[model samples]
Target: MGLNAPLVSPRPSDGYDHRFTEVDYLRGMERLVHAVQELSLARSLSDIQRIVRTSARELIGCDGTTFVLRDDGICYYADEDAIAPLWKGGRFPMTTCISGWVMLNRAAVVIPDIYADARIPHAAYRPTFVHSLVMVPIRTLEPVGAIGAYWAQERAATSREVSLLQALADSTSIAMENVRIYAELEQRVRDRTADLERANEEIHQMSLTDDLTGLTNRRGFYLLGESALRAARRNNHHCLLAYIDVDGLKRVNDELGHDAGDSLIADVSEVLRTMLRESDILARIGGDEFCVLVTEPGGDTARLKDRLAEAFRTFNTTQARPYRLSASVGLALTHPESSHTLDELLTLADELMYADKKAATESRAGGVNTG
Candidate 1:
């Protein structure tokens, strides 16, 4: 906690303090450069999650790491890269989750003695290997997510560790924001091109677009998406199916009015359009919900996910709307080698989407620990 402590290396899991020399700084900076490069090209939330956890684990030297997303009054464990499995897909109430604590407070938190910390739910901690931890919100102003680093023994996260983790968080925020911007620009160009092709105007007008946003409607999605999947199977191509739910739609409707909510839907559609190819199928399956079927040449499951995250990130930045737009996306991919049916893919995608949505919702809560 000293002024110079942050400049020192993090405490190792062996309960020994490590000294950071000039060489370590150079190595750390080098590692960070690689992290940024990978993150910049990462087009999916999982990619971002993986990169964050791996980089933090290496730089902070923690025994375990996790990436959490807030959804619907809960903190959902979206991904993890740890010495032992902690909460990969479990849901925790905001008050009980340290990651949630960071998001709600919009600040970083370090608990050297998690058992002694009243903020931590002791019962939950009793089963985990984590005796100490550090958590940082992905963004400071209006944070959308958080990252957690855990230690197997009682140890303090040095100032240097906290600063390093925060830096990574800031970098992640920028990567997410850029994804949003790219998707927006890409959508605008597509819209303009479609406008120029006047020959198809009448057919498109009568087509299956949602009345509010121009995305394909539920019927259109099922019809078109199923066909696309069938084609992928025939051609032996891989496919990615994603279910997306817009975050805070109810809040936007309540705080900003119905018209604003409608705008949010339209803007999010633009994001979806940008993330996929002209060949891919996208549909507005429900109010504040979208489904994307992607399995085209030069596209894989990982690439589709990366682009999806970019769309959400880009929308949050470029759209000058009163409310910030974000989404919880669950993606399920069908391998060219697997004989998975469209119905099977649908069930998986829907279940994953709800799981992610639940996490985002719980992370936004303000009440007592809902353990």
Candidate 2:
């Protein structure tokens, strides 16, 4: 290349090479602005590498450019844009490489002849096209890396070339810092999003559950029961809802205190849980009143009722409690296609439960009279 080739603009009418002229200076400024813009938009280390390697060479009109990172005790030639391959993807000790020296010294160096410079590792440069070079630290006060511009022939880099290289290196440092900031910000957003999701799920579960028995509450029953009914209607299936009221709850609460009454309710909940299948939806709909909705097509209400009676008998026989446990259960069976809503079924079940309580009271009175 000619003396003015690197910085010359197009020839004017006078056929003069306009190097170091106002036109050439404006063009250099334009290229530098474009490079800085590219660096500002870089999102990662690799992005910085790609932009720097290409833009540095273009701005300085060098034969090659390498972006070298200072890795702990080593100088890593991370990326390069060159006429031929430089030491890309290679690592050297901090004391052995020119790029490392630039970073350590926190200053730029212009080497006209690599052989003559005592800092140059002559054996290392013997086979390469690099003979003269200008290397600038990325950050001056505390350097993180270096950018090197290389030439195949021995030539002194002008002051303008060194300044341009340093400016680009400074921008590279800022771009790298921005990448770190963006990564941390993204991680925090992900963590906050996860925390919110967990909180929402816990709140949702609390709304649907009974505080004392840990069973599904009335609100849950209606929400889930309505959905189940809708599915049954679509599939032409049947549903059986059993409303169970704990017998003599008022007496237990009054005589033994609300604490014993609570124990009784919890015991009954356990019995129901033991007797019911995993698919059964059991809920504590009211104080001492529990409801079970069986949506399975093959469910037998009679068998379910028998199981409940047996479960209660087993609980009373096994536990030494002040009060005996018993429940009045009423089952309302219906096809969803009949247009019977869950509310209607629950109302019907409640009435049947009252009738069942009446029958049990009458049977006990009759037994006492006979005795």
Give lDDT per model, in order.
0.77, 0.83
Each model's Cα RMSD:
27.9, 6.5
Task: Give the C-alpha miss distance for residue 198 in model 1, angstroms.
Answer: 8.1
Query: For residues 1-371, could you state the per-residue lDDT of candidate 2 as single tens digits?
Result: 22234564443453322133545445656787898999899888999998998888777677899999988989999999999888899999999889888988998998988998999988888878988899999999889999999888767776666777788888889999999999889889999999999999989989999999999999999999999888877988888999998887899999999999999899888888887888778999999899998886465767767777777777777789998888888888887567888999999989988877776753441110110
What lDDT tens digits, residue by residue, belong to model 1 across residues 148-231?
889988777766667777878888888878777877888999998888777477566557778888778887887887788878
Model 1: worst 10 consecutive residues (lDDT sum): 362-371
Off by over 4 Å in 1: 1-25, 187-371
Maximum-lDDT candidate = 2
**What's the lDDT for candidate 1?**
0.77
lDDT of 2 at 305: 75
